[model samples]
Target: MANSKWSHTALLVIDMQNDFILDDGLMRVDGGKAIVPNVIKTVERARQHGILVIWCDGGIYGEIFWLKVVREHDPQGRDVELFRRHLYSQGKVGPTSKGSPGAELVDGLVIKESDYKLVKTRFSAFFATHLHSFLQTAGIHSLVIAGVQTPNCIRQTVFDAVALDYQPVTVIVDATAAATPDIHLANIFDMRNVGVATLTLQEWCEADA
Candidate 1:
């Protein structure tokens, strides 16, 4: 597939890290495991369509992508959110700490060489990051998102995408999830209200644009 057709589109895969999606995660997203296959499927479809795949994760270290490893917390978790600081408290390295196994992408999802890796310290991938400049430089204006825990990472990212004027932001409904179906649906509802497009993986893959 010639990438020219999708040159302006990018698929942002967020927070597929082991700590957030796997059975042994430190703070797993309740329904994250079930969507792993769908996320993989979405990545394959994105590649076939020639869309730039951007892998995203939250951390204080290295640039990453499927997701990358952060360097490690300050042992005291000062870099982490106040509520989540407990995760790294008491000298614990905490989940998704740099070089930690939990920061790795869940099994079955991979980040290809051509994909871009981005690390953020907060929920929105664009927050205090070069994501906006990178997207602008890449000439990307449309986004397709797939990932874990819709209410937080996914929702905040989508909202930020809209705020930044990324037209036609789309979320592959089945490829991303939350703690429960009701929570997922409610968040999806709010996104729709703000003009985000919510579709299934199949729907997104088949669309001409």
Candidate 2:
């Protein structure tokens, strides 16, 4: 799959936020920092090859998704009802909530001002966000995905991209993290078996070879 077939590819970095990646945050993915170097390298290589690099950040506010999660686990939980009421009260379940600093792409990425930046409220960037339209406008047919939290955002994004007929080549080295290594590994395996094509960072760098 390497051999100039990826020339029109775009690298979509998803939700490498401070809250999810940095220490001392409300929700941190374990080993999230370890993948940063690989993600940076992938972005740099994509740029060197003149591939489109689009960064996606999830600026999930107040917490409708959080409420859903808690409700899933414990339907009668007070925390679930509290957060659900808060998020619903604020009307933040859609495009109205974006552009927050929490949704900002992480520093240390090699992004130009002209490079694409999209803000999404859902796990799948293609949903509700302008990401799909942006990709279509750019004539992008393939996607190289990276970022944090394999089971959630990364997983959903890859599935949606594939469903939308984009060739999603996922860099496992750069793309994912989980609450535990076991869970991360399981998610990666599931993805590899289904939606996206798995590639190592080195393999993707040699894509033109």
Candidate 3:
């Protein structure tokens, strides 16, 4: 595994911001801040390999996403509408809210001026953003993904990348977390057994470059 061999690889840091990780943020994933060290390790490795690094953050204006979730979950008899209402009133996911300090990238994730920063309107970064085109332009054939909320953004992005014929490797240490350990563990299992290739921080760095 050598850096020179992975010039075409890229690293996608998904949704590791204050809003998703901080306690006061609207939707905080437990242990989100704790994963910073691991994410930093991955970012360093990607940079060392000359791999393009892209930061993907979710954004919303108004109650578009929350309202949709409420409708879908209510159909299943889930009590999500109340929470959705609260989130909406609290201004959680509305219009440039992601630019707030709480939604900014964590302290040490390493976003250099030369790196690319993309704001996504949905869970999957490729859905409504220029992520795919950016990768193609950079000749990126493989991706190393790390971010918050494993069951949401990280999982969606990895799945979407696979659907687009890109090899995706999700680093467990840098990827997902939920409100509880059980939920996080379950998500990791589901993702690994599905399409995404899951690895630890150390394993990912030492893997075939």
Residue range 91-177, candidate 3, lDDT tens digits: 345312533565466677645444455766566778766777866765667777776767777777777887888865554554456
| lDDT of each residue in 54-159, candidate 1, tens digit only | 7773111111112231223444677777888877867787877877888888889766554456876677777777888877876778888888779988999899
Which candidate leads in TM-score?
Answer: 1
Q: Write the per-residue lDDT of candidate 2 for residues 55-143, one digit (tens) a residue.
A: 67311111100000000112122223244334434433311223334333456764454544465555677766677776676566787
Worst window of 10 by summed lDDT in candidate 1:
58-67
Model 1 residue runs over 4 Å out of place are 57-76
- The lDDT for every candidate, in the order shown, is 0.77, 0.59, 0.60
Residue pairs with backbone atoms closer than 3 Å in model 1 (clashes): 64-117, 64-118, 65-117, 70-98, 71-98, 72-98
State each candidate's clash count.
6, 0, 2
Any runs in candidate 2 off by more than 4 Å, and if so which? Answer: 1-5, 57-101
Top model by lDDT, which number?
1
Worst 10 residues of 2 by lDDT: 63-72
Backbone clashes (count) for model 2: 0
Candidate 3 deviation (Cα RMSD): 8.6
